[model samples]
Target chain A: MERVTVILGERSYPITIEAGLFNDPASFLPLQSGDKALIVTNSTIAPLYLDTVVKSLEKLGVNVDSVALPDGEQYKTLSVMDTVFSRLLENNHGRDTTLIALGGGVIGDLTGFSAASYQRGVRFIQVPTTLLSQVDSSVGGKTAVNHPLGKNMIGAFYQPASVVIDLNCLKTLPKRELSSGLAEVIKYGIILDADLFDWLEDNIDALMSLDEKAMGYCIRRCCEIKASVVAADEHENGVRALLNLGHTFGHAIEAEMGYGNWLHGEAVAAGMVMAAETARLLGSFEQTDVERIKRLLVRANLPVHGPESMKPEAYIPHMLRDKKTLAGKLRLVLPTAIGQSEVKGGVAHDVVLSAIGCCLI
Target chain B: MERVTVILGERSYPITIEAGLFNDPASFLPLQSGDKALIVTNSTIAPLYLDTVVKSLEKLGVNVDSVALPDGEQYKTLSVMDTVFSRLLENNHGRDTTLIALGGGVIGDLTGFSAASYQRGVRFIQVPTTLLSQVDSSVGGKTAVNHPLGKNMIGAFYQPASVVIDLNCLKTLPKRELSSGLAEVIKYGIILDADLFDWLEDNIDALMSLDEKAMGYCIRRCCEIKASVVAADEHENGVRALLNLGHTFGHAIEAEMGYGNWLHGEAVAAGMVMAAETARLLGSFEQTDVERIKRLLVRANLPVHGPESMKPEAYIPHMLRDKKTLAGKLRLVLPTAIGQSEVKGGVAHDVVLSAIGCCLI
Candidate 1:
């Protein structure tokens, strides 16, 4: 078992990474006898893992209930979350009840948000089953449902009680989803850690083959990087903005393409390339570094370019509406190097258009 | 002008009480040039005060926009809040933008929750136009939108940057609404301040007539008491729960009768009387004290009893679903004496039913 504690003062909790941890009752630490929990998964993941999680909670004498929402990122809306709220109210769940999110990013985001707003706020545990969630979404406490006008436009920075990452769940991940997860895994390397990037390059084949040791190391390093960034700036006021390296551009792609069409990680994968190209154009990042970032994403089976149908001008509107835009200036995170990035505002419109133009083919 | 600072460390904000504060640009302190603000008012308040607020911000060189929602407690749902989100996204409002709530508790709660969830979170200013909001909702950070199954079931504890309370707005308030506000004014006296209770008894007529001096002092005192309580326990982990002296019962009355039919303060008024009676049955309260509580409520023209249509047994189910309920044990706030109260869990269900029965007639 590998553990990395997200040090957020009183809001801190451990992220435990291990094979078959979901079936182990002890992995759900801090939950005691008589605790009530509602496991919120999706229709797809529920049939695969719900019973095992329920049995684990029952073994610890915790009263448990389950609600499986329909699958897909398109279903991640406020109306869908209402179903969780309805089920909770119908079951008479109260302030003391803990909401356990038992699926990928969508489930974690929806369940965490339900917990945040249910009775003002309640404790929630993140049992992320997909690699994207286990490495990124579940660890950070950013819970939200997408609004029609934007992605993650409506949400809260409510942290989970603990995060239980079961590596065994990865075996069931679709090939496309596994590659989607690698996009974020690659993100940690570009924004902060050069060594991690080199490690990925060396062990890419092993990770793709599901080699236990390599997969475990990759997940743990990403968790550690995210935990430190969150601890330094929990609300994304400062250093934490670096974690959103490709999110501004990626959100534009996700919003333009419609959520669930291009998976979040895939959009981010392409957005990261756009950011690197933007940096290269601005003379802050080398052309070789931009190519390296693209090569890695390509190796992971992720998209490295914006959708060909989406004209570079198309991303401008959505980017203008991004949450990161402050004082009417669009802020884009641009990579200065493979292991370094900075949030740059006031990048000229034509320059951004040209950068997107460069990534099209 | 009177000021009470809600000392919540980094989240601390000042509550300013004055006549015509809403129209005075200076009352909106800490807002500067180049800042953006969106005023969220209701249909009722928009005609009366929205232009003045807009002009105030414009005078400060702050970019301003306005949205008027339908008036009434029934309209304080997530759907209505979505209107605010839609406007914000359409107008390209960003994280730096401030949401100004310009109405009663409903508007404050709806707008605050909108600001809290919009783009993860944003700064909001409270320009509470009703006595209920100025004295209670606006000062605290409890922002929420009502669910069909419950009131304030979905929300967050996001605080405002500042609260601007205008006494002049009260002059336009209906007679019944004034009395509704008095219920909360009377509540502060019962739950934590004996002196305030005695003052209400002595100047009931002055308060009823909207005497400027008396109303200002009443609102200021309530804000002070609430500020202290909130500072001690911002998340309602301990002392803050006492602030909901009659809310458990009040929420039931509101839910049972349907929201907007019985005003929140009116429901709370009757619920407080029910609480006093329950404490009397428990031997911690005197029959005379309960009568005094009822007499004060009657003098303010607020209801002192639950609706005759709602049976004593009807409140039990709603009470069980209260946010205060923990581990299946219903927790309630009962007054031990005038100006004193405690949160009691495990109170016998029969005693609660009998208390509600006594208040019905």
Candidate 2:
């Protein structure tokens, strides 16, 4: 078992990583004997893992209920979250009830925000099934449901009580979803951890093949990098903005393409390339570094560029609606190097457009 | 001007009380010259005060926008808040935008929750016009819109940057609305300030007549008590629950009667008497104290008993949905004396029934 602490003062909790942790209720979570645990999954993951999760919670004497939402990123919206709220109210779930987010990033984001708003707020634990969630979304407490105008435009910074990642769950992950997780795993390396970036370059095949040790190391390192950054700036007022390295451009792609049409990690993978291209043009990044990032994303089977159909100028409208926009200026996290990034606002419209242009084809 | 500070560490802000403060931008709010300030009021208040508030923000060189929602407690719902969200996105409001909630509790709650959820969260200022909001909702950071199933069932604990209370606004209040505010004023006296209770008794006639100084003191005192309680428990984990002294029973009344049918404060006024009666039967409160509370409520023109249409059994359904319920047990705040209260749970279901029966007129 591997454990990492997300230090958030008194609200801090541990993220435990181990195989088959989902089946052992006694050791996985800190739930009390009488706590009501609602496992929030999706139609897809529920059949695969719901019974095991429920039986585990029942073993710990937790009153268990389950609500499986319709699966997909397109279902991540306020309207969908309202259904979760309806389920909770119908079941007489109180403030003390513990909500367990039991699937991928979409489920985690929706469940966390639902817990944040239901009866004002409630305690929730993260049982992230997807690699994208276990490495990024589930650890940071950045929970939200997307609005039609923007991706993740409506949400809160509510943290989870605990995060339990069972590596065995990944064995069932579709090949496409596995690559989606690697996009974020690659993100941690490019933004803050140079060593992890190099490690990814060497162990790419092992991670893709679902080697147990390589997978565990990849998830743990990404969480550690995320935990450190989130601890310093929970509200994203400062260095936390660095975590959105590709998100501004990526969100534009997701919104313009319509959510769930393209996976979040796929959009982010292309967006990161656009950011690196922007940095290269601005004289902050070497052309070789940009090529290296593109090469790795291509090898991992992720998108290496924006949609060929979307003209560079088309992304501006959605980018304008991006949450990172400060004082009407489009603030973006552009990479200065493979192991470093900085938030740059007020970049000229043409410069942003040209960067997107560089990424097409 | 009088000021009370709600100390929540870095999130703390002042509650400023004065006459004609709305027009004095220099003396009000912490807004910057270039910040976009969105004034959110209801239709009822827009015709009366929206122009003045916009001009005030304009005087400080703030770029201003305004949204006027329909007035009424029934309008306080997630759908209504969604409209506010739409207005914000349509107007291209960004992270730096400051939302000013300018109306009664309904408008304040809707706007505050909108602020809390819009773009994840944004800074907001509270300009509570009615006494209910001025004293209670505005002082605490409790923000939410109601669900069809429950009052304040969906919300957040997002605090404001500042709370502005202009005594002049209350002069335009309806007589019934003024009485509704008085109910909460009397609540502060009963729960934590015996002196405020005596003061309400002595000045009931003057307050009913809308005496300026009397009304100012009443609102300020209530704010001070609320500020103190919220500072200790921003999330309502401990001492903060006491602030909901009669709210469980009151929420039941509000939810059952249809939210707009019975004003929140009016229901709370009657609910307070029910709580007193329960305490009296439990030997935690004296009969004389119950009479004192009821007499003061009546003198202030507030309801002193439950609606005859709602039988004891009718409340159980709604009470079960109350946010205060923990571990499936309905935790209620009951007065142990004239000026002190305690959280009491596990009372017999029949005991609760008879208590409601005692309050039915």
Candidate 3:
């Protein structure tokens, strides 16, 4: 077992990575006898692992309950969240009850947000099952639900008490979802770590083949990078914006394609390529670096370009409405190099349009 | 103008109390040229003072937009907040845009929560127009919308950039609403400040008459006490719960009667009386002190007992569902005396029932 701690002062928590950790009762620490816990999982995940988690908490002598929401990203909305609130109110779950998110990103985001607003905040633990969530979303404190107008339009920066990552769960992930998760793993390399990028290039097959040793190292490195960034800027007032390197374009694609049609990491994969191209056009990034980013995404079976039918102009409106846009100026995190990125404000619309035009199939 | 600053470290903000602060451009400090602001007022307050607020911001070279929601506490729901979100999205209001809540507690809470969740947080200013709001709701960072099962069940603890209290607005306030505000004014005296309680006892007539000097001093004192409490415990881990002295019972009354039928302050007024009775039953409080508390509430024209139709048993379920309930124990803030209070956990349910029965008219 490998452990990495996110150092956020009072909000600090640990991320434990190991195979078959879900079946181990010790993975859930700080939850003691007589404590109450609610496991919020989706239908798909509930059938596979809900009982194991429930039994684990039961082994700790904690009172446990479960609510299985419908599966998928489209289900991540305010109305769906209301069901969780209803279940809580119906069962009389109070502030002391700990909510355990036992699925992938959708479950983690929704449950974390429910915990944040339920009774003006309650404790929650993140047990991310999918690779995408295990590497990225579940580690960060950004919990939100999507509005029709924007993605993550309604949310909060509420951290979880801890995150438990069981590598064995990855065995059940769909091939497409696995590829989607790789998009974010590739993203960390493109945005911050050149060495990790080289390591991915060398060990991509080992990771894809589910080699436990290789996967453990990769997950630990990604978590370490994310933890340092979050500890430095928990509110995204500065360097933390770098983490959204592909998000502005990714969000635009998700909005244009409609959420769930294009998975978040897939959109981010294509968006990262677009950002690299935008940087190349601005003379801050090289053409080779853009190709390298595209190659890794392509190798991972992820989309490296925006949808063929989505005109370059379609992204402009959504990008303009992005949370990153301030004072009508679209600020995008553009790559300056394979291992470096910076937030660029006042990027001309025509330049972005031309870059999108260049990236489309 | 008299100013009291809530010292919350980085989130600290000043509360400015004056006769006509709404029309004064200088009252809105830190908002500069080219800034965008959305003034979220209700139908009732929009006709009265929305234009003055807009004009003041415009005078400061701020590009101002306004949205008037339906009046009343019943309207403080997620759906009403959606309208505010729609206006923001339709106008392309970005994160840089500030949200200014320009009415009473409902508007302040809905708008503040909107700002807290919109784009994962934005700057907001509180222009509280009611006495309950100015002294209680606006000064603290508790922002929420009511759920059918609970009051403030869905909310966040996001603070405002500043609180601008124009005392002149109270002149147009309805007689009942004025009495509603007095409930909170009297609350500060019961929970944390004996001198403030004594002063209210001596100057109840002056405050009821909207005497500017008396109102100003009363508001300043409440803000000071609230500021100290909030500063000590921003997330209610400890001392901050003291501020909810009457809220658990008050929320029960509000939820049981259907919100807006009994004003929040009116319910709190009666709830405080019940709390005093409960304290007396527990032998920590004197009957004479409870009588004095009742007499002061009567002088302010606030309710001193539970509604005639509400049974003593009805409040138990709602109180159990309160956010304050931890580990299935109903924890309540009960007054130990006229000016001191403590959070009593594990209080017998029967004692609470008898207290309600005794307080019921």
Candidate 4:
């Protein structure tokens, strides 16, 4: 097990990464007898893993309930979260009851948000089942439900009690979803860690093949990078915005593609390509570095390009509504290099448009 | 002007009480030039005060936008807040935008909640227009929108940047509303202020007559008392739950009566009368104190009792939904003496039922 604690003063908790972790709850999470626990997942993963997780929890004397939302990025709305809320209320779950988010980014984002708002907040554990969530969304403490007007417009920065990353769950995830998850794992490399990028370059084949050791190393390193960043900027007041390197453009793509029409990680992978292209145009990034990132994503079997359906203009309206925009100024996070990035406001409309066009070609 | 700060370590801010504070924004809340400002209010208060506040903000070069929601507590839903979110996105408001809640408790709670949720929170100023908000809701920084299933079932304890209680707005409030507001004023006296209770006893006639000076004193004092308690226990972990003296039963009444049917303060006033009776029966309070509280509420023209329509059984479910419940235990705030309290969980169900029945009678 690889361990990293998010140091949010007294509110901090640990993120434990262990292959086959479901067999031993005590090593990762503190359990109490008769504790009411809800594991939030989706239809896709429930048939594969919910029974095992529930049986394990039941063995620990925990009363377990599960709410499996429809599978997809489109389900990450306030409405879907209401399902989790209703389940909690129906069972008379209180502050002491723990919520376990046991799926990908969509489920983690929505469940973490539901836990954050249910009775004004409750303890939750992120037992992320997919790579995108285990590496990024589950670790950041940025929980939110997507608003009709903007993605993740309503939320709270409530940290989880702990994160339980069970590598065992990933064996059932679809190849497309696994690649979708890789886009975010690739993200940790692009904006924060050069060494992780080098490691991804070396182990791309094993990770793509779902080698347990390779996947475990990938999830642990990504979480470690995210944990360090989140510890410094829990609410994205400053340094955390760097984590949104591809998100601004990515959200625009997801919204334009009518959400769930595109997996979030797919949109993000394409958005990263756009970001690198924009950096190259701005003379901030080498053309070779941009090509390297595109190839790295391509090697992971992830889509390394934007949608042909979206005209650059179609994305402008959605980007304008992006949460990063302040008073009509769009904050674009651009990579200065593979290892680090910057959040700059009022990146010219034409620059963004041209970059969107660059990705279309 | 009177100023009291809810001193919650790094999260504290001043609550300024003055009649014409809004006219001169700089003295109370000076906004940085060009800062995006969202003015949240309802239609009823919009025509009355929005323009004046907008003009004041415009003069200072603040980029102010208004979200005028439908009036009445029935409209204080997540759907209503979605309208505010739409306008915020339309205007491209960001993390730095300051939200000014420009009406009463509904506006303040919704606005503070919107601020809490928008981009994971923005600064908010409470420009409370109603008596209930000025004295209690404005000071505590609890923010939420009603769930269809429950009142304030979803929310956060996000504090405001500043609170501006312009007592002048009360000049337009209806007689019933003014009476409803007195419910909270009566609450402070019952929970933790023997001196304030005595003052209410002495000035009930003047307060009933709506004496401006007396009203101002009462509002400011209640805020000071509330501010002190909130500062001590910002998230209702301990001392702050005492602030919910009548709220456990009051929430039950609000939820049972279908929310908005009994005004929140009115329900609380009636609930306090019942809580006083319970405390008396439990030997935690005396009979005279209960009578004194009821007489003061009645003298101020507030509802000192509950509706005969609700059965005792109907109230239990709503009480169970109260956010103060922990581990499925309904922890209630009961007054121990004239101005002291305690949180007792596991109060007998029959005890609560009998207390509810007594209030209805």
Question: What DockQ does each candidate score versus the true complex, computed on alpha carbons?
Answer: 0.84, 0.75, 0.77, 0.63
Chain B of candidate 1 achieves a TM-score of 0.99
Select the stronger candidate by DockQ from 1 and 2: 1
Task: List the candidates' TM-scores in order.
Answer: 0.99, 0.98, 0.98, 0.97
Per-residue lDDT of candidate 3, residues B1-361 (tens digit): 8899999888889999999898889898778889999999999999999888889999999999999999999999887888888888889999888999999999999999999988789899999999999999998899999888888888899999999999999999999999999999999999888999999989999999998999999999988989999888988989888888778889889999999999988999999988888999999999999999999999999998888999989999999998888878889999998789999999999999999988877
Off by over 4 Å in 2: none
- Summarize candidate 4's per-residue lDDT along A1-361 as a digit string, tens digits: 7888888888888888887777775733666677888999999889887887887888888888888899887778777877777787777777777888888878888888778777788788888888778888888788888877788888888888898888877777788889888898898898989999999999999998889888878888888788888888777778888888888888988887787878888888988988888777888888899989989988988777688777888878888777677767778888999898888787888887888888875
Expressed between 0 and 1, the share of native interface contacts present in candidate 1 is: 0.82
The residue-level lDDT of candidate 2 at B103 comes to: 98
Clashing pairs in 2: none
Q: Model 3 in CAPRI terms: which quality?
A: medium
Off by over 4 Å in 3: none
Query: Candidates ranked by DockQ, best first?
Result: 1, 3, 2, 4
**Which one is best on TM-score?**
1
Docking class of 1: high
Worst 10 residues of 3 chain B by lDDT: B239-248
lDDT string for model 3 (A199-263, tens) is: 99998888888899999999999999999999999988898899998888999999888889999
Q: Better model by lDDT, 1 or 4?
A: 1
